[model samples]
Target: MEKNNNEKLESMDTFKKLITALDAKLDSIDSRLKQQQGRKGIVKYYRNEDLKRAFGLSSNTIVKYRLTGVLPFTKLGDIFLYEASKIDKILRDNEC
Candidate 1:
C-alpha cells in the first residue's frame, strides 16, 4: 500500500509539471498574437519625394496636387506625409 501511494504521488507530480509547461507555451502564443495584432494597426506615411516616385509623377505635379487639394496630406512640422494606401488607390483610379 505504501509503494502504491508513492507511485500515485510521483504520477501527480509529473502531471502538474506537464500542465505548467503547457501554460507557459500558451502564454507565449498569446504574446505573439498580440504583437501581430499591434503591427496590423500601425500606420506608415511617405514623404512627397517618395510619393512622386511611387506615383511616377514629377515633383511639380506632386506640389500642384497638394496645393489644389487633389491629394490628401498631413503636415508633421515642416515635412508633408501622405498615406501610402490612399495614394495607391488614387493612382489606380487615375491609371497613372
Candidate 2:
C-alpha cells in the first residue's frame, strides 16, 4: 500500500511538471502566430503618385511641394514616400 501511494505521488508530480512545460510552449506559439499574422491598424505609407492622385495635383506640383517642404516625405531611391498623417496636416494647415 505504501509503494502504491509513492507511485501515485510521483505520477502526480510528473503530470504537473508536464503541464507547466506545455503551457510555456503554448504561450510561445501564440505570440509567434500573432507576429506572423502581420500588424493590424498600423499607419500606411503613400508614394508621390498616390499623393498626386489623392490631391489631384500634377507631377511638377508634387516636386515643388517636396522641395519647398510643404509636405513631409521619405526618399527611397528616387521614390518619394509620404505619410498619411503628414498629408492630412498639410491639408489642414492650408485649408482656406
Minimal lDDT window, size 10, model 1: 48-57
- Candidate 2 lDDT over 1-96, as tens digits, reads 999999999999999999999999999999998986687666778887787787788999988988998878887898878989778887788899
CA lDDT of 64 in candidate 1? Answer: 95
TM-score of each: 0.54, 0.53
Best of the candidates, lDDT: 1
- C-alpha lDDT of all candidate models, in order: 0.87, 0.86
Structure candidate 2, residue pairs in collision: none
Clashing pairs in 1: none
lDDT of 2 at 41: 61
